[model samples]
Target: MKTILPFFPLNLVAFPGQELNLHVFEPRYKELVRDCVANESNFAIPSYVKNKIEYGTEMKLVNIAKEYSDGRFDIETKAINVLHVLNMQNPYKEKLYAAGDVEILTNVDNGDIILKEALFESLTELYKLVEIQKVPLNTDFRVFDIAHQIGLSKDAEYDLLQLREERQRQRFLLDHLKVILPQLRDIQKSKELIKMNGHFRHYDPLEF
Candidate 1:
């Protein structure tokens, strides 16, 4: 279905089921949040990548986390669906923030169990290598829910927004893991070495 939504362009990508907390300090976005909360409306957070607005996620404003003295606000939102921009109008209807006509993109879960398990395991291991002991998992989870947690880049996360198939998203994130896990391990190893520097090392000189 197509509809118009308030647009809040951000440098970050918000994935489905992800909770995003935003500070609304700008005059435009402060008004945006107020309107959303008053009307119980959802807004689009278009990923501002490479100086251009691209694909985005539709998010429901959950609550006003806090309100500053100067009328600024801290708000919490949850990404509920993906949005494909039909077009956007800046200063929409003379309002401060931009608005967009968008089409909702639905996700297809083929339930590729093997692929899901593989991706999940790899994600867990990636966190483990970084000494993250408890990684959260939803019993019935979509790949989008964990994409941000698995170290996918903002660009890659935006790419995932375009994908409808769960298996495909899994593969996309797995590729990110393949590239990042090794680098994280190397970094961890370096950190370990740095910490061990100046520690006492008592060993036999040469036992040849």
Candidate 2:
């Protein structure tokens, strides 16, 4: 069904069942937050593509993680569903928000157990390496949830968001990581070689 939702355009994509933490500082968005809190309405987060895109995810406010004295908020939200934008009457005219007719998406299945298990294993390995390298992540989830955190390119992330089948999404993620793992291993090996020489820089630079 079509609904007029308060819209927030972002540089990132949000997936169903994922949690997003946002710091809302703009006045219009603060108003949006107030409206949501008062009415329990869901908001839409569409990826901004120079021009606004017509697809996005519907988000439900979960908690106000923090509130500044200035009325800004550090809020957490969960993706409840997807939406297809039907029309944008104003096109980003709002200071910190937008409005549009978004048709809610339904019928996508939850992920399968086997795919979830495999994804967890791959993510665990990935995070172990990340931890060893001392990268920091604010929130944690199962391996499947890591897909929501890794910095996939915009188009790649949009493609992932389009996969409606749980197994298909899992397989796509597995394939994506399989391609990435080799490159990551190569980078690590190169780093190790450079470290052995006490330079702590890329080994290829030594050849120069």
Candidate 3:
């Protein structure tokens, strides 16, 4: 069934069964949050491509984590469904709230525990490299979630959001990591070479 829904365009992709914490400071989105809170309806979190793609995920407001005196909100939301936008009209043009018709997507079936485990192992190794390099990251999730964070590209993330089934999503994550790991290995090797040569930042100008 197609329904008109409130739209929030963001730079990131949200996946079903995953939690997204948002800081809502913009006035239009504050109103959008108010509307969702009042009507108990889900909001669409679509990616803002250069030309605006019509695909997005629907998220349910889980809890209002915090509220500031300035009427800003820190809220937690969970992706509940995927929606394909049929049409969009910028109703609140000043603050950028869009109204659109979206069709909910059905779930796909594709799960393999072995694949998931292998993906997790690969992700853990990647995270270890980051940690050893002292890269500033506040990664607190398990290997699977971490893989989802680092493995997915902007477009791939949008595609993952459109996937309805948990199993298919896991498989997609696995496939993503399979392709990403080799590249990560090359990056790690390059970093190690730089470190052995007195780090990239401390390299002597005359060495070139």
Q: Pick the candidate with the highest TM-score.
A: 1
For model 1, residues 143-207, the per-residue Cα lDDT tens digits are 87677677666777778888988888878877888898889889989999899999997877997
TM-score of model 3 vs. true structure:
0.71
Alpha-carbon deviation at 74 in model 3, angstroms: 2.8
Candidate 1 accuracy as lDDT: 0.85
Off by over 4 Å in 3: 92-96, 132-147, 164-171, 190-208
TM-score of every prediction relative to native: 0.84, 0.73, 0.71
By TM-score rank, best first, the candidates go 1, 2, 3
lDDT string for model 2 (1-208, tens) is 8899888778777877889899999888898898899998988998765455867889999999999999999999998887788877554554356788888876456667887777667665676655546533333343335566554677877777766666777788888878877777788788777778855555455553
Q: List candidate 2 stretches off by more than 4 Å.
A: 49-51, 65-71, 91-97, 110-114, 131-144, 197-208
Task: Judge candidate 3 against the unseen true structure and give its global Cα lDDT, from 0 to 1.
Answer: 0.73
Overall lDDT per candidate, in order of appearance: 0.85, 0.76, 0.73
Give the better candidate number (1 or 2) by TM-score: 1
Please give the lDDT score at residue 99 for candidate 1.
99
lDDT (Cα) of model 2: 0.76
RMSD (Å) of each candidate, 1 decimal: 3.3, 6.4, 7.1
Scanning candidate 3 in windows of ten residues, the lowest lDDT window is 135-144
